[model samples]
Target: MTPADPARRRLLLAGACLAAWPLAASAARAPQRVRDSRALMGTRLDVAAQGPDAEALQRAIDAAFARMTALSALMSHYAPASQVSAIGLAAGLQPVEVAPELMQVLHMARDVARRTDGAFDPTVGALGLWHFDAPQSSIPTASEIRRRISSVDWRHLVLDERRQTAYLTERGMRLDLGGIAKLSILQSGLDTLQAHGVGTALVNGGGDVVACSQRGDAPWRVGIRDPRAPQRLLATLEVRSGFVASSGDYERFFVQDGRRWHHVLDPRTGRPTEGVRGITLVADSLEAVNGLGTAGMVLGARAGRELLRRGEGVEALIASADGGLWMTDRLRARLVPVAG
Candidate 1:
């Protein structure tokens, strides 16, 4: 299929959501497969096996979805009643005991923040003042941005590994997992499927996709959407086992006064990233892809590539704000450019 084909994009989305679920009318089908109910994470999850394994596949999919829902409830900062929100409310006053999953994600968040030199900070919760998704959007004043920037310090997050307690060193500090949590959950789902005797699986959460297992007759193909032309494809990657995560300025943004304000906040400035239209990362692990995607968006183009290069098992493709495209040697080798 052509990468830019609308049907291809839709199919990709369907495959990502349903993972192993067989398409209703597709000519291909495995011996045993069943589609499961959608999960609270808003992604479709299904399983397909080659033998008389319907019951086993169903159980595996159900267990994976349940774990994902529980993790979402615990780590969601938007849900004021979640553990993350509770910790934000109690910031600086007392330590809050977090779930093991939450602690693990937080630790990874902190490490990425340090590696990116605070570019991919979890403390971007301070920028809660702006909502680009709103109908009427306004840019925060310089003074307001400065005030919020002061609260964006990843070091303030103190974790007691033994007790699984996390304390925010300052009041008003919060953790926004919108950056990586969903992809992390997808990775975990893939791992679960692998353990269930499912030799191959694909997990696609919106723009992020993770695929594993021996290749079929043809290598698995992933399309890279064009930010300037959503209906068109920019490139495709032939991947067998790894993760692909993308962050795009086009997905969530508001145009005001001839400028676009997107959801990707620069912790140092408390403003949307500029000069970067989108970033996509290919990595062996979800942690690397998710972390680097965020860092790449914040670092823009040049520095973002450097950041990805420093991390092992990671490669990146960057789309500049001006519509120029660049990829590291590692990524270029796997990329199949699509005609505009």
Candidate 2:
């Protein structure tokens, strides 16, 4: 149940937390784009839209934020009152009935864990020994890690479709939806926008963005960070629809003895993963790229690339631990490399 969004390592510039972008110009007859931001799940959530009705678009944005807020309350691992916490609290006891949305995300997490061979597990809730947050950032001892790692299995989490419940078979097991819930919530935000008939809009949270463009409008532009150069952007990605999700060591991390420890843990080892500095994925749907970004981080470069290559339209941008950059063939076409 770690707090999300460190305001670091994200490709897009978020509110008051990322590198600054230049002011934009508006043409005399240009249509107005309404943009608003709110801090949700510890990250800056932004919504930008351009349409005929500015007031209606604003209302749509409000509804989107409201949907995200409600979903996070149900699924946030950090929230003690959340259904996720309740399921963990009932581990080894009995199944806990959960909301439909929580059930859907749980199913999604299980699917990702299955596909990634446990690399993208949501059941790493017990591996919370490392505190990356300041004032108490401490790494766990080997013994502690071993003890916690024993309970970090995604297989033990069972969901009952008929009963609408979630159960962890093992005692002391925990659930941390920090990985996938954000995207689902944000997807819900986009759904809210569409429900309100706002077609062209972008929803950005943390470093992840989901957006669409009108037929006559220019595509939404997002800046992607260069892991090798923290202060610099590697490239800009234009989006018409779909999503851009990223995972990096810089997100929630600390250094000890020159070694960096991050929140993205290897479920098997119950420690921070290695051999990849960051991973960014762009695809047509959340289902296409849900846990793959972090999975690539855990899988490293070659295997990560192979994994991504398997998917039809999943474009990847991987910054390896050695500082080398690798990307999918198709992704190169979507990028405009940033000039120094």
Candidate 3:
């Protein structure tokens, strides 16, 4: 999907109860919040904040954009000279040390990869054949896929916490943080805002949203887009605190020969996942939810449900390719089911 599509937009909701400020009054005095959205990290970032704090908010937004740009440069497999690209060059041969931030993200990516059994792998960078952003991207051959698949190994990624470095054991191995870095950046932005004493803000980075504040009256309202009908709303979540993130194949895919090729590549087979079309997750932390959504999608309906059941403070909604929908009990509590 193109960036203009609403389905590609990530929405964050934050709500808080402030004893000093009433909800209606704060809503009235709501800082003059402005939004600036641009293509960053291969996705859109929507930032909004209120009060005379506009200047601080703008600074915070600029800081976030800058950080995300750096992250994209470090993690993008498309860039031939990026840190990730360097790792690819040394894959299966030597270990490449990475920056501290990159190392942290890589550690999280590796954990998700292991916990999800490679479903949410950062090593899918081996599948360099398909281009989701291209106008006419085509699928690669089975043999080509297999050859590259051999290089997709998350286990080869070695992290030294004491040294704060990341190493790729295989010669052609690469790291693609597309699954989690954006959320990390968003969380960083939120932390920045909070540090600046900006209690109210929303960071919506391409459908991975984190909202929080010790102020505000009612819960933050977040809209979930209907996967089958992008123009319509599926349900509205009232988030008093915490975050909500969603991943859907429909956001980035191409239709060729009646087959759909999405961006969420499976590390095991180096191909876009089938079965589940989309997955939405609600949790208190981005670190927890970052790779979980992709893992849930790759696990299909049953396994996805099982994963959610085992996770605490996490709720999920899954949409299948066959048009069937499933929701965890926690998610059901938050959503008002639409009549069939």
Candidate 4:
């Protein structure tokens, strides 16, 4: 055939476009990696995963978030109808049966309380009457604090493992798992992702996070946000696996008389813990250092160092209000400070 005409050339191009349409659509729909986030347990929970297809990744994300929702229902103090609230209502009166997961978290809370010498008491719930976010400014009276402090004893938390029951020996006592429960829930979400055959995933429960596998060939990188400047990062880490928990005094608090009255309460004083501004701990599991950060804020640098030394693979970076940083050598090695 001699040289084709312009009309013949246009018809040939149209045929080629129609033939490639299906393949272009297929490539567009192919899934590589995805991230999902939702607010649950009174905090933002996030999941990142890589999958062969979008549907599989969505299913895994749903499962992970569902696990968090269930745990929150069982443990959240904000939920008046929750099992935790029920236990509070029945305090000192009867032993309330609870789910195995709740029992496990409570046990872990007790362990932290003992290890911290009551510095990590979940019984600080007795001090919940104080509201930092109230429209009208108010502080708890010393007499009222003293009376509430009487019921703020972790020793009074009686658990019957045989019956899977929890009891508070004081009528007005309450349990607040605000410190440790988040980490436990994060671990549970990671476990759910694993069960769903997702090998590469990260479950971030607010400031606490856990990674299952590398981000592609490289390790997952996470930023530790600056406590003083919420928008800036103090440091970043290249984490291959395991947990990172960051606790800060600025997380929930109100300014009063030029002082930050935060939510990290000390059961002993029935008031917010002072001294340390923030603490970030890296460990193999939440079981290793779940509530240590909160207790570290109360104990200050000297005792915080001693407490961290007791753990085998735990590393920490603690910041004080004096603009000084106290960090374990191991954490220093892995942490990259953000350059100003």
Q: lDDT: which candidate is best?
A: 2
Which candidate number would show the highest TM-score if scored against the true structure? 2
Predictions in order: lDDT: 0.72, 0.82, 0.72, 0.77
Clashes (backbone N, CA, C under 3 Å), per candidate, total 1, 0, 11, 0
Q: Write the per-residue lDDT of candidate 3 for residues 119-154, one digit (tens) a residue.
A: 788887778787877775778899999888987878
Could you tell me how far off, in angstroms, the CA of residue 84 lies in candidate 3 after the best superposition? 1.9
My TM-score estimates for the predictions, one after another, are 0.85, 0.91, 0.87, 0.88
* Candidate 3 worst ten-residue window by lDDT: 15-24
Which RMSD values do the candidates have, in order? 4.5, 6.3, 6.2, 11.0
Q: After aligning candidate 1 to the native by TM-score, how far in Å is the CA of 225 from where it should be?
A: 1.2
Off by over 4 Å in 1: 1-10, 14-58, 134-139, 214-219
| Predicted structure 2: lDDT | 0.82
| Ten-residue region with minimum lDDT total, candidate 4 | 12-21
Better of 2 and 4 by TM-score: 2
How high is the lDDT of residue 188 in model 2?
93
Better of 1 and 4 by TM-score: 4
The 10 consecutive residues of candidate 1 with the worst lDDT sum are: 15-24
